[model samples]
Target: MMQKEWTTCFPFLNQMPDDERRRFLQSAVPHQLYAGEVVVREHSKCVGVVFVLSGELKVYKVSESGREVALYSVFPGEAALLTVNCMVAQETPVADVSLAAMQESLIAIIPSSAFFYLYSVSPQLQQFIFSCMYKKFNAIIDLVEKMTFKNVSERLYEYIRENTGSGRIPLYTTHAQLAARLGTSREVVTRCLKKMQRAGFLQTERGKISLLEKPEP
Candidate 1:
């Protein structure tokens, strides 16, 4: 891959000096992941800073009951916050949540040491890293707030709408995936979805959910 062409799509790296950018590009290791592949597991050390060049991943936590709860979805141009934490701390950061590829993905993996070196020398990069930390922290806070206040049905609606927006119907996801995102059981999510379908709000088929009514954000 051409270094200049690849980094052009990434906003954070675009602000670096040419020499720094070249060095950083040289250090990156590209990785490809198929859907359902585990990117990182809970309590395991992060291998490197992962920058998603394309496709999606879900960051989530699993309870003792083996129920999975999604924390967030990471898209292209975003890096894992745990990786950044590891870079800043100069130690292998143990993950509290798991991450898995939601779709086939292209990712650029930068060693923590190389990232830290750039962070120290580039003020712009330092600020960008700090900004990433702030945004991810806020995202976690938002997730907590939503889960605490929102009912299962409402949360399911939000999740569907988030993925599909108002235009598309029949989002490609399983009931188990929806349950994970909503922090509920698959049975509960199925029940809620059925209710919505009956109420003319949505429809569910095998491996898909379609909105019958456009939901508010």
Candidate 2:
């Protein structure tokens, strides 16, 4: 029954015939994570693939100076396949996984050996893998473009615009956290925020930032 629940969370598996779904489910092992747990880490051996049945996970990389730059956030019904690649290639993981639970969560762990076998035999699984890889690849490309060509202010603006549906973005982050997200120093972020505040673009008080302008395109 738990296996059925795990399979249901994966959209790719939903279309599969029952027999095939059962085969896929047989390859997975159940696992649980607590809030604030490190599910994976940089330079660590990857054990298997993770299917998040519940909860959220933040995928990030730590800088040499020990700063975390968040890459993406994963929630229930999403899976992380990078760990499978690492185990298959016998290489260390490139990022760290931090579990953030709004509530308790469960996951299905599929061992690398079983995953490889499934990939070899299942055409549907292959297509799913390909689609996932393509999306991840495109995301990395987008990140590169942002880091290389976009200024910190632009990035911050984009971040704010993306997160807030309305023109007014009520900021709920500290200056330091904003700096990390912008890939700049806290002083720089503070300076930019001050400038924007003066221009009526936004305002900040007690670590809260609010966007006053709709942000220019």
Candidate 3:
């Protein structure tokens, strides 16, 4: 996106002080990424703050056996806290999480020093950080609960319901992606998905899956 478009997405940038705004703009580098591109790899240190200006990003965790569980996703207008965490804490952040482009994406990269400076001086930015952090924390906690307590079928059902909210939109994803998000094998997900298709809970065709009806309580 152009400077005008980026500023429009973040209107507060127009209100920032001259020096602060200059520093912010100077540090905010742009990156264009393709689908499946990993933004932050497992065990890698933060280079800078990353936020999506367009498209989507999937942040996930991988297990020892090569399974993956989604942490959360960063969409247009959402700021990722991974790099921010590193800047604020000073201590080394965990590198187990990976952030990848879910589709064609436009990301703005901000320097850590500039991020810290703005974080200290801009109340609006600070408020935004706090709000984003709170949300990210709750999501991680929910993921932990699912991993610990929910059975695979139950988790798969939950994932389907959550992603295809209101049951109107067909889930635009593949079995492999679902398996990665669920931290299970593709065969396991495919088996269960086939079972779901037979049971009238869902239908799969091509690359998308659509929920058929709400499950019984």
Candidate 4:
């Protein structure tokens, strides 16, 4: 019964043999995190592969200057690849790689030893992990290109378009959170957002942003 739920969220688990599946499921543990809670910290030991069963996780790295630059987000049915990398390499991440709950979240942790054993024998698990790596690698490349070539306003507008898939964006985060995601300061994000608002590009309300005009793609 419970196994069905985990396999539903992580379909790859369904491909495992009964023994391996039972072992893995028996070892995996679930945790709940409140919004704004920091779950993984810099230099902390890699605990296990984190599978988000519900809600969102933000993956970011902190700089020496106390700035945070978001790498990507982990949604339901997704795993945190950085944690997988760290666990595989058996090394503490040096770039201050961090993970936090962007909202109230329910996540499961597959113990490192169990994950390592399963990864060795489960081709399905390997495929899923590598697939995640490939997709996230491209996203990081895109972020780097934007940071290198695009101006702040252009980057911010691009972010808006990406998130506003339905032409409206729920204000799920604060200006500071936006800055971290955009690799900029809160003040810069605020100024750019205000400028966009004045330009009639969007309408900012208490908990949402409504697009008045869509940018030329």
* Best by the TM-score measure: 4
Model 4, residue pairs in steric clash? none
Candidate 1: regions farther than 4 A off:
87-92, 214-217
Candidate 4 lDDT at 120 equals 95
| Strongest candidate by lDDT | 4
Model 1 TM-score on a 0 to 1 scale: 0.90
Q: Please write out the lDDT profile of model 2 over residues 1-217, one tens digit for every residue.
A: 3656665677778777787778779877887777656777776777778877887666666778977666656667766756656666644444344323323568777877787777787787788777767776777778778989999888887877676554545767788777766667888888888888777777779867777765564
Candidate 2 wrong stretches, greater than 4 Å: 1-8, 30-36, 91-106, 168-171, 205-208, 215-217
Total colliding residue pairs, candidate 3: 1
lDDT of each: 0.80, 0.71, 0.82, 0.84
Task: Give one digit per residue, the lDDT tens place, for model 4 in 77-121.
Answer: 888887887776645433248899999999989888899998999
TM-score of each: 0.90, 0.77, 0.87, 0.91
**Candidate numbers sorted by lDDT from highest down:** 4, 3, 1, 2
Q: What is the C-alpha RMSD of each candidate to the true structure, in Å?
A: 2.5, 3.6, 2.4, 2.3
- Tens-place lDDT per residue, model 1, 1-217, is 5865566657667778988988888988998999989988888887678878889888888999899998888777677776666445545467767888999998888887787787789886777667767777888898898889988887788878877875375699888988887788999988888888877788777887777765454
- Clash count for candidate 2 is 1
lDDT of 3 at 143: 80
Number of clashing pairs per prediction, in order:
1, 1, 1, 0
Cα lDDT tens digits for candidate 3, 1-217: 5668867777667777778777777788899999999988877888788878899898887888777878888877678887676555556664557889989999999877778788789876777667778888888888888879997888998889888894788898888898877778889999999998888899898888899895584
